[model samples]
Structure formats: structure tokens, C-alpha cells
Target: MYARDVRERVDAGRWPDVAAVPEASTARTAITRRVLRHALGRLPLLVRFPDGTRLGLGGPLVDVHDPVAFHRRIGRSGLIGFGESYLAGEWDAPDLVAALTVLASRAAELVPAPLQRLRGLWAPRHPEAQRGTPDGARENIGAHYDLSNELFALFLDETLTYSSAVFRSLPASWERMAPAQRHKIDRLLDLARVGAGTRVLEIGTGWGELALRAAARGAHVTSLTLSAEQRTLALERVAEAGLADRVSVELCDYREATGTYDAVLSVEMIEAVGAEFWPAYFEAVDARLAPGGRAALQAITMPHDRLRASRDTFTWIQKYVFPGGLIPSTQAIESVTASRTSLRLTRRDGYGAHYAETLRLWRERFTDRAAHVGALGFDATFRRLWTFYLAYSEAGFRSGYLDVQQYLFTKDAARTDGAPRETATSTTARDTTTAAAEGETAP
Candidate 1:
């Protein structure tokens, strides 16, 4: 009989939900249980069961309440099912980020070597509907960014800067986040040589922060975004700042954008550009970049090997958090620029640890404002999903498996005379040293 039939029978009092009762079993479930047991035993984590049994060498603790359901879910959908199991209350972790950090650190070695090699045969691929075509890009971007700006404001700092911040120091305080965000924007502007009367093009107008800053610097800024929600709120914010005359926020895709500018700035938008369109995205940037102009991009990146291995495999992040997102590697960026455009990678600064801290602050704020989130009409499942997403991302940065970088690129014939030189060399050196110590590198 089907599992659902048995479940209905039990619920109707015809049968009891007990270990003594016969239950349907599948080959997939049996294999998943065995593989999971083997894998969990090797990791540096503590997996506790209701029966007082424990697995792994013990680091962060994972408490499993329904082993059968957990195994079944994983069997059916792999990592995606793992996330769903959490949403279903089959598992709990006292310290979610710590537990996930352990998993992320050992992610490459989770499955057996043979299975890892054969992943393409069994792993789920990204849905074609989520591909980043012009239309698909709008749909994909709207899926996340259109989720009310008020919801984001509950957690994000006042600046509404959704990307990573460059903190002045470690143990960042809540008071420092907004200033750090501005610091990061100013650095990108400096790298792009933005100045008075300069014409600037912002590829992704994230609530118009960069555009507002560029306008404040006396530059005429034209910013593009695909999200209708962002465009609406960004326009409001621009008007509030009284910079509407200098800045124009358009609900336009980079591919559809017209006109050349002295500087092109896209912060943390490259991840949303699918790998298939990376060349197109860069070509668009190159096409609009004025001669002797520079471009600055802030991107979240992964190791090249990891990027290649996971690019095609569907994950929980792709399914729920970011529909069409794919983190590129420094190698991928360098290769794409060299092969596709005249843009050359001039400088890169990695600050993954800062991103981890930023996420920590955001998660804490989210938790503290859970009631407000519920009041806004988001259900429990959504809250759990967002919690998992934020912690999962934070763990990735903590484990050195992911990094956020600000990259500076200049065209082949770019003139150097007007470009701004570093005024905070000491600070840059310190940040670079920390990044290097964390195993981050520039291409």
C-alpha cells in the first residue's frame, strides 16, 4: 500500500503509529539511511537521536526528532529535502550557524568519493524556468526583491544596503553598520574614479544607495534594476534625498540599457546573472563603458572547483532564497573578462569574515523582530526558511567556502591620469591581510 494510505489509516484509528506496525519501505530510503549514517559518523558534529544514540566526533549538536521522516525527506530530494525537513520540525539545532558551519566545511567530502564523481547522474539540476533570460531575470529578481521593502527594513540597517559591509574593525556594533556600508560604497566609487560632473551607470540599483551616494558626489547617475518594487522605493528614497535631479532610477535590465558612462558600478548583482549569461552581462558592461572609464563590481564568490561542481546542481538556496543565483569564482570572473571583453581585473579585496558578521547582526535582528515579521503576514514556514537561508550563508562565509569581494576593472585603453589613488593604504593592507589569513585570494 502507499505510504499515504497507511498514514490515513493510522490517523483514522484503524492502525497505530508504532514501531511494531509494518510500514512501507523503499530502496531509496534504505540507501539514504545507510549513506547518511556513514557520512554523519565521519563529520566533526554531534547528531543526537530521541533514543539517546549519538553520531559523529562532536562539535555542534544536531537533535533529530523524527529520524524516519528526516531520512525519507533526504532520500526523496537530497539537500533540498534536508531543508524541508527542518521546516517540517523533524530536526533542530541549538546553534544553527555552528552546526551548519561544520557541514559546510566538510561539504566536499560529505558523500562517498564514488557518489561524488557520479553526482551528475543523480543530482537535481536547476529548473529551466529560472534561467536568466531577459524575462526570466525579471521574474527571478522579483521573486526575492519584491518581497516588501518593509520586511527587509526590519532586519537590515538604516542604509538598506543588502550586500556585505566593510567594517572599520572586528566585533562590529549595530551603530557601525550604516557607516560601514557607506564606507564600502565610497571605496567602490573611488575605485571607479567617480567625481564631480562624471556620468555614472549603476547596473543594479539596490534601493538607490549607490546612486544617492554618487549624486551626493556631484555625479550624474543613471541606475538600472529589474525589480518594480525596488524601483518604486528607490525613487521615493531618491526624492527624499533631493537628488532626483542628479540621479535617475530606471526599471531596466542591463541588457536593455543604453548610453555610455564614465563609470559602471554593479554591487553584488553578478551572482544573479546565471553562468550562461556571464559573458552577456560583461559584454553589456563593456558596451556601455566610456573609453578610459573604470568599472567596480562587488560579488560573492566561491572556489572555482566548487563553483564548477555545484553550478548545475539545484540546492535549497536556488529553490527558495534566490531562484536564479549562482556565485562565481575569481577564476571565472578573470576568464570571462579576458575572453569576452576589454575589461581587465585591476584590483580585488575580499572580506568574507565581515559578511559573516553582517549576517550575524541581520539574523539577530530578524529573531528579535520575529513578531513584527509575523505581523507583516509571513507565516512560520517562511520565517524558518529565511532563518535557514541566513544561517546557511553565514556558515559558508565562516567556513571559508564563500567570499564577498569588491573588484576593480579597467578597460584595455583606460587612461590612468585621472584615476584616484588609494588614500587609505594602511586600512586596505590590514583588510587584505585578514582575507589572506582566511585563505581568500585575488586572481
Candidate 2:
């Protein structure tokens, strides 16, 4: 009989007594008894085993009730269980990530939630923020990127780029690929053409890696960021790199940044501006660039009307993680930049796989450093929430639900009709090259 049926019978006190056959081994009987005990605890909840065993939580199962709803909520053993259960609030584990890690690395299993079946037909849609003011931008950027710098540092590469990494190959090497990220960033810098003595401007400078790299290339760089922590950390990085004279990090919103630059680059930042404000973002970039300057941007893109039918992960992210953030499609970015000051899409690359790898690395780092993370003032629940964020994102990328892109933008003037630089290198050239070759989608 199905577990659900057994559960119902057990609930009505009609459960059968333990079989006492002489042929049954004592160990086997004991194992069955123990499983039944656990199942009894999940009485009302249906626990699904990967082997098609439906265990009822009534009767003997009640003796082994899940104190934390671990079995009742997440029947499957892995990241999905922890993430799905936490999102549904079925279980209350102090560290969501930790709880998930245990299940993720365990034996094969899947536990389905009863509520998902009940609410399968319901879906609520929200209006997209077509337009947003500077205030809105500040709120969105701060909400997601402003999470603890220490947490970010623990997992990110030396550059600390929060966006997708460019991998050199499929299933990129973790042991031999430490230098892949450096090459990818260098390629982006070359695309911008910010060379020695070039006056460069960077918008949404999260963690200041790009700004520091530009300065290291001998460029006079001005960087803008909305997060106070980011600005502080960036300034510290600049000072340590002895680029204080050439690099200036400002705690200002992008809308307020004004100046002419030999080149401009904004990595994974424009998506937060919303579609309505995209024109302003392009204009801001145009205004800051010199007559022949180039601009490069990296962002995540989705299809038109994407996420309409799928679960609204955005709803959860908006409410709990990224308050006002939004992701736009490539069409949106193209439309916004088409009209103003003749822009050309010089090169394009997709680093979705790189991002997946990055997330995996983050998951490992976070799992390994759980103790330190707990010590950093984040409670167990917060840890689980953070883990869910990374794991689901990793799964999303692996499953092709998310993408990352790098675009090279050049002014009509910079197009001098001359061929652009094909490749570039940095002190961390090997790392960047490995990443670019593995994950980078060549244009």
C-alpha cells in the first residue's frame, strides 16, 4: 500500500501490529521497526523516498517524529531539499546552508512537500519596474551587494568579481584553474582600451577589483559605488596597491557620476537600474567617455517575459535578499543604447558555466568555513538562507535558467574603422586565461 494510505490507516488507529514471523531476521525486523517509527512521526506529512516508498507519519512513525521537519519537508537528499523547504518555511533549521549541505552530500533521496501539490495551480505575477530613480537604484544595489564583504571574500577569486567568471573549458579544473579569472578580467579591460595614462571611469564598482586593475595598468581611474562597505574596502585596496594617487573610489550613486573618461566599464551593474532607467544609464556612460572612448558592461539577461510561467524566484529574492533588484534581457539593453551617441557592440561572450563553477566554489568555501561564518555574526538560519542562495543559483546556471554576458561597447569615433585588440593579459594572466577559455562564449 502507498505510504499515504498507510498513514491514513495509522492515523485512524487501524495500523497492523509488527509481523512476528520466525523467518524474519532480528536485524531486518529491527530496521523495519525503526523506519516505521520514523515514518510515524511524519504522521500528517507524506514522506516520499527515492525508491518509491511512501512512508506515513502516523502510528509507529510518531515515535520518530522529525524534531526539525527535516524528513517531512525535504524527502530528497541534496541542496534542493534545504532550499525548497526553507523557502516554504516547512522546517526551521538554524543554518539553512548547513542543513542543506548535509542533505546535498548524502545518499540519493527526495522528499516531496505536501503543500506544493495543494498550491500547484496558483501563481501570482507582479509588475516589472520599468522605470526607477536614483533612490531605487541605491536600494537595489545595496540590498544584494551590500551583504558582508567578509562572506564574499571567503569564496570569490582574488579579483572578487561578483559576476560570472569566464571559464576556458567545460567542467573547468578547480585544482589547475585558479588563474582563469585573472585572464577574463584582463580581456574585458583590453576591450575597453584603457591603457597607460588613460582616464577611466567605472560605475557600480563592487569591491573595486576593476578599478584597481585599471590603475595597475597605469590608468587614472575614478570609480563609483553605492555601497558604503564597498567604497571603504575599495579605498583600502587602492591604498595597499599604492594606487591612491591614480585611483579614486567614491561613495556616490551612478546617476550622480559625471566626467569625461578615456574609457568606461560597468560590470553586472546595469541590470539593477531597471528598464525605464536604462536610457539614463547609457547616457551617463556616454557623457563620461572621451570622444573616442570605449565602454564595456557585463550583465545577466533573460528572455522576453521570462519567469512568467516558472516559479517567481524573484519574489523571494526581492522580499528577502535583493529588495529592488531586477534582471533585463539583451533586447532591453540593445534598445536603450541604440538611439544615444552611436554605440557599437564590439564583442559579446557568455560565461554562464564560469558562474556555475564560481557558485560551486562559493558553496564549498561557505560549507568549509561554516564555523567562521557563524562567528561573523550570521546566525544558523542566515547561513542556511545564504547557502540556499548559492546552491539554487548554481543549479539554475547548470540547468540553463540563468546566463552571464560581457559586452564590449565602443563609440562611433573609437570605431575609427580599425581592428580592435583581440587578446589581453594581466599579472594574473594565467588565471584569467583559464577562465576565459573554459567558460567564455566567443563572439
Candidate 3:
């Protein structure tokens, strides 16, 4: 705790110093220019600065509103400071997602290879205080999810599903997002084989959509969540859906959950498990799973090398977005399960492009409902931060730097399969899904 306090104090003092500085040092500009040239040269991106200066060969434009601050921040903090620039509104792009996609495509090479391993020397460590302890988890989860249901409502579809939505195919626009979201959940429910007489356990119930769906299928569900705001509304939604008798919503930690379930599922919740407690999280799932039971998880994953290199390093996403979150690679998940538990990775369906489209639709919806979001008491800065977050995520997928996947994990893989799936697999969505699948996909 003392160490965390000291680090927080240092960061508090440092960001102000950076923000107050009027100009970058001559040496800093030289470094920034060199990095930009190598980093942006291969990409078709145009970077416009305050002084009418520009960089990049030219695709979409990155308008650097405060070049000096940006340069200084980059010189000091590297990629994280670039995100801070976005939060500070120091830079923008004509098409934010497109411009970010250009950068995300080169994220691996942005700082040069030799320096990548050196990130530990300066990269922020995930704070000790933010570990997923019972109390810490609630505080961190509430920082984003419990802010306001109305705030999320401004942007999300009627379903209120916050994670990546899988689509049959990438839609051209936002009009089809609602149905696509249902389809996404449908696939997970299918993977878990939720049906009549099934005793299902769902972790991280986001507004009761999954629970409602499970109940609709005549399955009895016990759903867990940390957000009080979400729990209230989720229960209300369950009652409204007239499935209250079949579904139970509890305000509890995953570690606190008891009783066995015939099937277990969590949607995009493992990211918040923190690497330290991943084993415990899986253990909780294992303990709750009945013999021959199945588990399906939707995850967001990064490439293995990137996940390994950056898993312990904190970033803008951890700072201003989802605190205590980490995108686990397939290797990390497989290794954790193999070493720590009996569950085996049986099948995976990945659709990174689908996530890009899902994010695009959410960003558009968020922007289109800006006034409503503002009226919900979120300030302009909040809007900017969230906009950047959504766009940044969209870019990650667009560049194939990130992927969303559904995985079927079972205790007995040989005994589990041959049941009919609700949907066919796709290279993008489900067609490519297979029981023999071996690569990583995310929840």
C-alpha cells in the first residue's frame, strides 16, 4: 500500500509537470521526429501539427492539437503518453478509428524491437491496490460499470451487452447491431449447451441479458456480479422478462460463489480477473462445475508475444478505462488451465474483424447519442476519454492486433462433442469453428 501511494504521488506530480511545460526540449523533438518517421513512414497516415507542420506519407490525418505536449509525453512515457494525449485532447484524427488502425497495425514496431524488452524499466506496473481482492474488485469494477446505467444506455443497444458482439458477417453500418448482439450471446449459450433442466452459472451478469436468455431457454441460472447498479437493473430486467423464478442475480464475487452447476459461462469477464488471480478464478469455475459439465467464455486476446511483453505493464486502458483488466493470450489461458486446473481447451472460434465492426457500431451509437450522454452528467472530458477508448479498441481489432473469441472448455473433451451446434462456423464468425481448434481466442 505504501508503495502504491508513493507511485501514485509520483505520477500525480509528473503528469502536471508534463502538462504545464510549454515546449519540448530540442533533444526530445529530435527523438520524437525520429520515432515518427520510422513509425509512420510505412503507413499511409498524415499527421498534422499545430504549427502547420505535418508527418507521414498520407492516408487519414492525425491532427496534433498540442504537438509539444505530445512530443514530451512520448519522449517520457512512450505509447501510454500517446494515449494520454488523446485523453487530454492534444491530438485527434479526421477518422479516429481509421487513423488508429494505421497506428495499431504498426504497434509492434512503434518503439523498435530492442527497446521492447526494456519497457519494464519504465512501464507502469499494475498497481498492488488494484488487485482483484474482494474489496478491490468491487471498487475497480464500479469505476467503469457502476458509473451510471443511463450513461451506458446512451451508447449501448437495447440489450445493454457491453462486450464484443459477434455478427454473421461484418455489417456495413450500425443498423444491425442489436440483432447481432443477440446472435453473439446465442452462440455462447449454444456452446454451453444451455437448455431445459440445465443448471447454469454465469459470471459478470451485465444487465441480465445473458440470464434472461438462459431463462428463456428453460435453464435455471445463478448469475454473479459486482456492480450494484447493474444488479438492480438486471433483477428488474429479469422480473420484466418474467423469468425471475428461473434466474437468480446475486451481488457477490466469483470467489464467493458456491453450489455446482451443470454449465458455467462468463462473457468477457476474465479480463478483470488480473493475472495474479487467474488460477483462482478458474478454480472457482472448476469447483462449481458438475461432472461432464461444459464452460464457454468469450475473451479478448492479443498476440502471444505482445501479451507476454506487456501483461505486467500498465497502460492508458488500465488507467483511464478498465482498471485491473488484462487481455490474456490463448497461451496464457491454456498454460493457466493446464497447470492450475483440470479444464481443457477444446474448441475456439475467433472473429477479430467482427469486434472491429462491433466497436464501430458502438462508437457511432455513442457519438450519435452524445447529447444524451452529456445530459446524463458525463462531462466533455468523459466523452472524449470514452470516445478514444472505443476507437482505440476498434483500431486494435481492425489492425488484427486484438481478437474476440468464444472457447469451449471441458473436463472431458472426448466425451463432450457431437452435439448439434446452433450455428455453423465461419472463418470470421462460426464457419471456421472446430472441436480440433488449437489456437488462442479471447473472452
Best by TM-score: 1
- Whichever of 2 and 3 has more TM-score, that candidate is 3
Give the TM-score of each candidate.
0.89, 0.67, 0.87
Task: Supply the TM-score for candidate 3.
Answer: 0.87
Q: Candidate 1 regions off by >4 Å?
A: 1-25, 414-443
- Global Cα RMSD, each model: 6.6, 12.7, 7.0
Ranking by TM-score: 1, 3, 2
Give candidate 1's error at residue 258 in angstroms: 0.9
Tens-digit per-residue lDDT, 163-183, candidate 3:
877665545456677777887
- Candidate 1 C-alpha lDDT tens digits along 263-283: 999999999999999988988
Q: Which residue runs does candidate 3 get wrong by more than 4 Å?
A: 1-30, 413-443
C-alpha lDDT values of all predictions:
0.83, 0.60, 0.78
**Model 2: lowest-lDDT 10 consecutive positions:** 13-22
Candidate with more favorable, higher lDDT: 1 or 2: 1
lDDT assessment of candidate 1: 0.83
Angstrom error at residue 330, model 3: 1.1
